[model samples]
Target: MPSSPALLRLDPTACGLPRRSLLLAPLGALAGGCTPGAPALQGGWVGTHPERGHRLRGELPRTDGPLKKAGVLIVGAGIAGLACARELARRGIDDIALLDLEDEAGGNSRAHALGGSLCPLGAHYLPLPGPEAHEVNELLHALGLAREQFGRTVWDERHLCHSPQERLFIDGPEGGYWHEGVLPPPDGAVALAQYRHFSALVAQAQRELGFAMPTQRARWTAGHAALDAQTFAAWLGAQALTDPQLRWYLDYCCRDDFGAGADTVSAWAGLHYFASRHGFHAPGDEAGEREPVLTWPEGNGWLSQRLAAPLRERIHTGRVVMRVTEGRTGVELMAWNEAAGAPERWQARAVVMATPLFIAHRLLASPPDALRAAAGHLRYAPWLTANLLLREPLLTRPGAPPAWDNVRYGATALGYVDARHQTLDPMPRPPLLTAYRALPTAARGELLSGSWQHWAQSVIGDLAATHPDLPGKVERIDLCRFGHAMSMPVPGLRGSAALAALNAARGRVVFAHADLAGYSVFEEAYTAGVAAAARLSL
Candidate 1:
């Protein structure tokens, strides 16, 4: 592995600037002291519209604008909010208004067009939904991505991730790279045995209690719930699975899904990562077979666009919802319209807060004790994603062909995914590589304090380990910083009273978001939105 560039350290107090100023700082300022003639950052920064979110910290200006009335008001036009709107429309409820802070409605699932390819800025793939994931299954079927076959759900083959799905670049290996699957090369008998043993355990859990997505459908027995009390690392220790290769592979899985490692995530979540997939099969495969994942160039952003397409006029983008208050007649909401530069009040019979718990806590007026407790207990992981527009495929050692998902062992990043892998046409000359990195162990303060250029350099440096010539082949690197990317399923949090409290509807205000399910998977977000809509009907 190549060594990383020297880390750049910054002091906000010394610079006499607020932490947020770093996020908006010019790349040139971050590149200060760089060697003359060094490669300058080619692309600008893009993100989840942090400015609108930052406004939440300050009080909004009261407006004299006329009140707008609606039967239902959905806040935060992410997957959860869009799902709520879709469900409401399906029930013939068109008096619904969906509001979002960003110009786009996908939230973290947002994607950007690079050349002719669409690359994801956040979420990139969706696992095949199990039978228990009714909402997800229904959504897929509606989207024409799946079909029922012989009592099981079968995903369309074209959308399924192509073969040679994954590859790992291992350090110190004979060839330094291993092709095919996420499992490490079988160099040692003990390591191979440990890997099989762990797989057996996951298979057993799936057979007995069935790890269902959205987590709500999973059988939550006392024995299963007890896994939430300890870290996944501790569980592995108890099981005596101490192979370094196995540990690295498991850690990669945790980071890929939860943005945290085994030491940080709850054991139950770790187990769920492996066992939650059920009742999905390939087009011609029988039941219980491992189903191929469904993906597009834009990832779940494609799904989000489909969900929001029918309700474009009803969905209001660039609107920050400031507050929600309960009244005798209905729920009243105060939102700041960025374009109009004024606060607008809206009254609705019911409101679905399809946002993160932290934002919901800030927006709710006089929330109940349970809601407050739930908000306090929740924690989020920060993430950084960079879409590197390469002139050609990345330079690689002779091994397997470029897989859809590429990973490197002993690296900080989870590796890059080929955005054009799903394209029916031949791969473009300048392929887009969507790189991902999660700051699982870093403090939120640290993540917020870093400049965009700092993150870009970090990503480039990490990628240099495998593709040393990556900096030269890159056309532009679009960086995105997610301060509160996804909710962390820490020990003792998943099945706790706090999560349950957060999921429950308070009066006419129904809470929704992937965080409610303690995992930020597509199924969780979809389920939360559908459930929130159902609650409004009740």
Candidate 2:
């Protein structure tokens, strides 16, 4: 396990986790290294050891140890990697090993601690799985989060996101006020009219052009292709739905899930956000309801930890894949062991490149056209999650009380999630707010170059409006940055022929990652891993 910041040494009471949970809660955080970009700050980076990942672009470290052998070697150890291993095991293929660059598994869906509280460092929340996501549905059932009762799906109420699920702080003449939901209030008659039109459009989309969560589940037609060929913003413009508030809300939704707003992502992605999960709803509509999500203080890290627990002995961390070579006999992988400070080699009959498509492209000795093209067309979004420990609750505004998901209107940042919102205890001690910001591709440089203090201050300032005294209440702030957080489903990327080819590829090395899906989501990544494992000849 990586050493977390010493700021959380106050006591366990500050954390909402119970005593038994304190013992049983699986926590694996990435270690931080001093960088040229570093200076003295109260908080530091906690995710994606940037140094280790960036090392791939530089020179080599020669191998020193004897070659390690395995029946199968799976790289990544993320949600996809872990799922691959689990599926392979279920098939009675036990002779396998998993490796990751970071000291811990869970890639983007990892956990960290702040002021004794377990908080999400990256991706959080798992929405209710749709019918076509059989793999995910099974996993939820196995984990006791959901079950089929009398031919109807039933969830464990405890795991479902508590009511008052989300809210948006809308700017007004009176500063800003909290709205019950992330959607804008549709302030004017024109906006309201546009809202109803959009709602009907969503219904039309569901009826005429079907949408599904896993995407693979839905049938791809000319209608889907047309939507994929243009940007969401372009599509919106063509519809004559030029309402500012509606556009802002649409942009916010795009940024939240796909990492880019309407101008960047394809039209299919924007519509899929609402149409696939639940149709767009205006206030007073009979179907107006929020989608239930499963969350904990540590977010999806809760699920990741459980997925990783069963295979602890077989998992290896801090092993950066140097090169991958496939031969007539088997596959050869050279990995650099970070902790041991030595190079190691692995000989495996089968290898799964369960990493981002770009990373896999860099690793392979001879890459296929499909893999190369897929990697070439892809663009990853830079993500930043800052977990701030609050000494006390923030001052609440009118409307709904505090919510699990809090967003600020017209803000570039996605806003923050209250880590303690789901706590069963009525007593208050301290709470951690996990603030998320998905930056544009251009800002990747600044994200990597900026000091932890600079970014921490920026995050605090961004949220300061919602809580005027936030600066005073915060005890510590720990920020995590991912350079290639997720693949943005830009126009034409989803229906690209190259992705189809890569998904169909079979041999000694099988590719698996969210990148293969042209977008990042738990369902896509998890299913991709399982599919990859199934393709294994073993």
Candidate 3:
């Protein structure tokens, strides 16, 4: 579908900028002509390597080279792959090789450099690990980001999100005002009651129906399965929690974490968003506190980088895994080495497919019934992240001070995070802003279609709703696209019996990706990886 001009504030008379052909359509179909103005926008896709992986869709050339051998082989170098390798190393399994399609590891957790600053390309933060996410806690403790002080786990203060943590741009009588947090404040008596009511509901969900990070650890009950059967919007409607502001914030949160809205994701996912980690907080709740998250300028890429550091010697990048065949002797893997432009064969006693379920479907010579069922039940969201290099500071709106995470009311995009927020330097020299937009399942075709310019313009237009002067201040903009970004936790996905069987599979070719958990997150990926490695009898 051709996109109409989206979120662009048109003012051709003021700046002489063209407006007609703004957001969508590329082949001159609905739109094909327009000069990008104000400041020359220079950017192309970064991080994700679709071209390399897309080769698997065609008839792959047979392997013609000498065989490479590893005691244990991992097919991805993302968090899961890396964690699996580390776990294998811990288990005294030293012969390991990780083949990745991208030139760099980190998958969606990758980062990009823009001008003098480093900004995130995908996932931006990690909330403090909960009790069940022991692997993540162990990783943090090993990284020195957290430590035991007086028998209590204390996180490094420098790594936590700085004060003025979040702000929401809301329309007001005078003009638009920035609220102190992402949640909308009570506008009236009814809204206040609704806010408190939602908070209580989240508490009830947490208390009765348990939720946990790496969600698989949570005890799934009939109540949870009932919630998992319907969309979050329907559940909210049943509760009669229909305040527009409250809905907008809830939808925003769904988009932020799950890459979709409440209407699309399951009710279980919606409540789990609040219940799993931090319970919802009303305005005046004394027990309320903003959940602290570990973040860096480069976001979770920081963690990925450290995870990849020690395993650098074992990791092979730019290798497009084409086929995986299991014979009576061992597992044979064929990969197209993108750099060499040749196909190579490798054999291992055991293989860990740390890639997504869909990719695993493509790679396996004969995918099992469980893998087929799991892939069939899952759907993925296409994500776009743009890093804007600004020449000057953005004009502030009224209300709260500038914060790290800045969001607009009823925005199509999730929001922008200031890269300079964590900086120790007090001097203000205009910082880079990383904007995130999670597109709908319908938009996956448009997102994958080559048009970084149009997508960049769309993101700029999305931000223009709040920062009108942003288009002029942007020095450079680089966009990153993830075609099958994160698995959308639609109704029935979280409760799929196939996932349970797949997760517990102890086989020669092990599946270890976020898809086993029905969605993508650091904890799930890491835990899946560690668990997969543990199941490997090699």
TM-score of each: 0.89, 0.91, 0.93
Q: Tell me the lDDT of model 3 at 27.
A: 20
Ranking by lDDT: 3, 2, 1
- Candidate order by TM-score, highest to lowest? 3, 2, 1
Q: By lDDT, who's the top model here?
A: 3
Alpha-carbon runs more than 4 Å astray in model 3: 1-39
Model 2: which ten-residue window has the lowest total lDDT? 26-35
Clashes of 3: 0
Task: Compare the candidates by TM-score and give the number of the best one.
Answer: 3
lDDT of 3 at 221: 100
Clashes of 1: 0
Worst 10 residues of 3 by lDDT: 1-10
CA lDDT scores, all candidates in order: 0.77, 0.83, 0.85
